[model samples]
Target: MTFLNHRHSSFLRSITQIVTGALLFVAVVSSAKAQDEKPEWKAGSAAVVITPEEPTWMAGYASRDKPAEGKFHDLYAKALVLEDLHGTRMAMITLDLIGVPRSVRENVEQRVEQEYHLAPASLLINASHTHSGPELRSRYLLVKRHDAKWAALADQYANDLEDKLVALIGTAIEKLAPANLFYSHARAGISMNRRLPTPGGVTNSPYPDGPVDQDVPVLIVESPDKELKTVVFGYACHNTVLGLYYYCGDYAGYAQEYLEAEHPGTIAMFMMGCGGDQNPYPRSTKEWAERHGRALANATEAAIIAHRTVVHGPLKSAYDYADLEFAPPASREQLEQDKESTNIYVKLHAETLLDELATSGSINTHYSYPVQVIKLGSEILMIALAGEVVVDYSLELKRRFGNTNVWVAGYSNDVFGYVPSLRVLREGGYEGGGAMLYTSLPGPFTETVEERIYEKIDELVQEVSTR
Candidate 1:
């Protein structure tokens, strides 16, 4: 009887031990999963003045804004650093300039990569496309006159800008802690498609029927203490408000200023969307610019108050590049007339093309375009593209893959020139063929521009989805 009782006790003890071990295993797995599920977001921001004090040639549309006599306005350049909790990072530097030359962008990128070990795709540099700013690249085509003074100044400015950006990124990383990201979108109808359809049913007339991305996407950054640190918003409209000589960030800059003012202590970053063929309608004065800025700020405030969608969990990012070539311009004889004309931009570009054609015997074709996509956990996909992208790309992407989870950005990677669709190319307007004279490209993009863009985007999306 004693032996049987002892055996029963031993069996009970073994069963209890087994049960406890199972519970401990489950608890460990659950804890690990919870740790893995933590949302990742780290951010930093810095701003510098890239505006030139002296009068310089402005870029963007051919229209020029005369500078006020002996007066200068403040112009600003800003950098925003975004990274996952694990330290993988990306930096976006927005300049208050007309455009940045490819060489300038590449040099800065190389420096950043060498210094910080940042991937080229992870660093996105963009221009506000402010027509009131100085000309970074020579707009003249025929006479290759180098503004050594301006070039030297620009180089120094870029270097300074890079250092400031790096510092800002570092600060953001250091401040990273428990935070939450919320996204909300609203459409503001201030932007109108500048490319219109002609009476002959031909598209690309300067009449204003082109597609516009009115969706004002807002990303609200909150600290662990539940304070709003920043509001990053994007719109697809050219900031041509107050197009006067003194350097200014234009409507985009005003918008950021207004937002930050309204929400004291909160930073506002404006990511210009696909506004190549879009403009802020009724923009002719500084007051109008302020009004537009207020509208955007109001929209952001509404999103925060009404519907805030918070993003949680780890972040995943992916980037890819594609080379799309442009077809050679018209024959030298055909282009010579334009080249010899007073329009230095056209003349210089024509001569360059002619020289290339003469040397290669055939016009060189194709541009190496890059498309980058970043996914933040299961929510929010940010797609960045090169060039002055028109609104069609943004609209199409949002429509195809509901705007709730996608944010499309332009003026990213490289700003070689305007990137027009096949439809726009066929129509042959400024964004399509007319603007080619402003750049060093041999000619307008080949008809395959649309195909190449679509294919690359598709590949990028697929790659992210699979990952």
Candidate 2:
């Protein structure tokens, strides 16, 4: 009887020890899972319709003879503010317009700093390069038509837009909440290299063999409960699918619209990549635009579905200007001759330069081009380059940065004109120099343009990466 009782006690003690060990292991695992699931970032997003209430002059194509009469859909300006665990914040504002003027960026930067205490380095303004959006540059209209009414309308719209954008940023920041960030990418075949090489020169035609960046990079933001919040995706293609009189965001707008519809209560923002020389094929109709938009949206969705890298962050941002030199300005005699030409754009450009020479004493030999870099922990490196950047920059940067999670965006901050790579510049094409005939800038950039931009980008990247 004593031996039996001792055996029962030993059995009970062993069972107790086993149960306790199992519980301890379970507790340890649960704690680790909880820690892993904790949000590493805070994010907020807001979007506002920017479509003009009244008849507004359209941007992109200068050939349009009249103001916009109707609408395919309303345009938009969206803001997304992201904060790291340490409280470093970065605000990304995207416009469904032709470009982000330097003036607009400067104004927003100054006001956001003053009002919201958001540093200029923390602000990133990108444009969709939508050809159908309202003309934000009053001077372009003023110089082209010499109509004060048109210029005033555009100027008034721009001023109102500034206020709207600033308020939108504030709203986004106010709505910040705990969130998770992710990075993934998928490919879409909508963009084709428009810089076709021909015996004549580089014509703006589809070059199937030419390099293109069709990889659509996506940044997903979601709540801790796994509710999708914001989807920010990027594509390296011109948003010039439909150049109709009515306002539209083209394929970009359609993609955002589709994404938002598919994910109810979510905001989608499109960032233009280095697609200065890329264009969608079979374009010019609203249907085609919608098709391309759907394609891009599908690609984004696929990216989201794919395994995504967890974007851990103690976000760091840096911004600076690159002094991009213009090739020597056309001589006075050349300008004088150009002013007398039959081409209105050429004459206007020459007259604009001559006026600048008269007013400022000399033509501007260099432009203070804006360059920005944002590093998300050690996982992601985002480099935003101003102007209509060519595809080469995108490909080269990805190559140089190892292409894993590096995102290079163009048409950011100040999309003054085309930014051709050294290859494109040496090739001598529309993007190389001929496109300058349409702008008031003094023709092609100097050879050092690419080098100077790269130098600044490297400096900024190093500055942000270290912190």
Candidate 3:
């Protein structure tokens, strides 16, 4: 002002005022827009223990010589129900078991649709795949599923489980009330890639340098008063800590227990991630499992304390099936030859296939796999894929669905077997095609396994996110 002309000084002052006014206007508009987009949710949750009443055959270990001797803790099937403003409801059922058979899923969905009036697409059933949990009945594990007495007991257990799951869903929906949901995550390091490449090929051992997902994604559901009600968290690691005679939920079980203890009267739900190839290291004992569980629970606490994004949701969901092709079954000559092999599992597998061919005349060449996508508010995308999914799917989906929150979950709906990525299939390890020798599946999947799934996910995301 000391040297400037009078008109020039006045012009500069006017320009500064205009720019400041514009910035203030923009900030106010942004605040209003955020308020408009925020969403309110009605949430209800219930937890029920699903452990078998009697000592029964446990799942997940082929080397077990007898039935379960004792139990470290009871297993659970927890349900969370959320209703949007439009009265549309979505229910999530998480189980502490080896896997949910396709039949169980089908029957439960049918009953829920009839009883609760919930759409098939609105319900998601996920299993923890805990190796220590009791074995459910299956038509796939033809090699060594269970003997007559145990099989009968397992069938009865599954029947009772379906009833429990249905009732829990109803209970949660009945308890629905106003709530706020937020999303946050932290990291845990107990899980490592168990498939190691050695001179002998991909061996099931801890490879510290291999790809692993240490993410512990958490969703916090709170009542109107902001009191915590339910906590849903995920980790991409197998529940195989203790392979002892006692039934347990493994590390995932212990993690849930610790969380519930820390926050009394709150339900902690654990959803297994794409952990088909991941395993908790330093495992094989109850103490090791507890250590890993503490690590996971602490990770959840860390995520709960970290900065979180408020989840405003109109709650959109989409579920569909993708037809995945399989390589042709082994020739009849190969089956006959396999029956003479020394490996008992291999022989049993061959005999089962031969019997199937005699009865059905042809083997199934494709599987109709389920894939789901849910949009939370405007930013978060949840991709729930069926199977024991590998880690590549999760990593690749996050990359493809850029600028949005992505959570890819495996072991949902129907967990047929290891759903290998194209890379794993080509690498030709147990997950590739070798494990098929123990199931009714034909063989390794066709090369389109990963592409088909990704395409279906893209389609579902597009469908759900359009609103």
Candidate 4:
């Protein structure tokens, strides 16, 4: 009886040991499988000098009498390429120029698709809209100055820019490596509404009581080793802090410069926000521009140090064009009358329209405005709107998409002219249609401008979210 009991105890102990060992083995296998299946991010960055080598005519300010004499610093075209775990890629290119010309966008887009197999929806191009950058539109130069030399120079610079941009995109793609992304925001009070309300109408001056967007959205990319690689930040103010004859990136350029200097080996890119009707206070001097840049850089640093939401990804993007109808263009008779106006801009605009009528038989009836949406996992939703977008659009979208981190970027893809909200259009200010005199667009967008834009944006948001 004693021998039988001892044998039973030994057998039970052996069985318990086998069961425990098997359980431990299963747990180890499960943890290894989970780590292998986890998703990761990859990112790359590159920048190239884009400032024209010659004395080129400046954009934005039509009253400038001559080409640029010098530059405060060289302008840049920077590219940031991001790839997700599934190998899907997106490229974002930011320029320190006044605007992204349609030609440049088309040229670079076609090349990137052909060379890198990148989809059209995955490319985002934004311009800083600095008033002191070189004017790249040959037609505008021809109409304004009527000098063939100036037009030729503009054409040459544009062609060179197209080549440089294509090469830069390639470099960024080649450098892609393991990375981590974070999204955070801070506010800076540098921008104010420039359309002041008066008894007569809305004038081009700072309005203290008008609506403004001071939110500075930032995206920080770092290596697996926790070294910062790139910082992309945005502000809703015109990069028009200085308008001197010297070529400069204005506040946007200085902001990027300061950030890169403060953090060596890190690339900093600036995206323009909805600041069509906003301007910096105490502008028009180099010192003011630097001060504003420092302020913005400090705000960006604060965001970096603050709590950040990790940006995860199966990255998704959608892009489409909104058919924005135009109001009736100026009649031939009206153009003839305005041709004799004392204001050079008014006269030049009329003459240009007259030439357009002679060439095309009618002014453009509508514009195919571009609208883009990009989703970084479930945490961040970035909307890039073309043209000089007004603050109302940004404010409204933020309210509508309050559940996610919404970053609205204006002056993207195409910067043909001002894009006014329904309120701005109804108010009939410069951003509404008065600024159209400077662009080839015939007149202010119809009231459906805002509706059409929102319709396209909503469609894109739905598409990206579902995907």
How do all models score by TM-score?
Answer: 0.83, 0.94, 0.91, 0.91
| Candidate 3 residue-wise lDDT, 112-144, digit = tens | 999989988888898999988887754433246
Clashing pairs in 4: none
- Winner on lDDT between 2 and 3 is 2
Model 3 clashing-pair count = 0
Q: Which ten residues in a row have the lowest lDDT in candidate 2?
A: 1-10
lDDT of 2 by residue, 1-467 (tens): 46668779889889999999999999999988976875999999999999999988889998898899999998999999999988989999999999998888999999999999998999999999999988888888888874678889988988898999999999999999999999999999999999888888888898999999999999999998889999999999999899999999999999999999999999999999999999999899999999999999999999999999999988999999999899999898999999999999889999999999999989998889999999987778999999999999989888888844899999999988899999999998889978888888988999998999999998998898776
20-47: candidate 1 lDDT, tens digit per residue: 9999999999988866665467666666
Better of 3 and 4 by lDDT: 4
Per-residue CA lDDT of model 4 for 298-381, tens digit only, reads 999999999999999989999999999999988999999999999887898888889889998888888999999999998899
Clashing pairs in 2: none
Please give the ranking of all candidate structures by TM-score, highest first, separated by commas: 2, 4, 3, 1
Q: How many backbone clashes does candidate 1 have?
A: 10
| Worst lDDT 10-window in candidate 4 | 31-40
RMSD of each: 8.5, 3.7, 5.5, 5.9
- For model 2, the superposed segments whose C-alpha errors exceed 4 Å read 1-37
State, as a TM-score between 0 and 1, how close model 3 is to the true structure. Answer: 0.91
Off by over 4 Å in 3: 1-39, 138-146
lDDT of 3: 0.88
**3 or 4: which has the higher TM-score?**
4
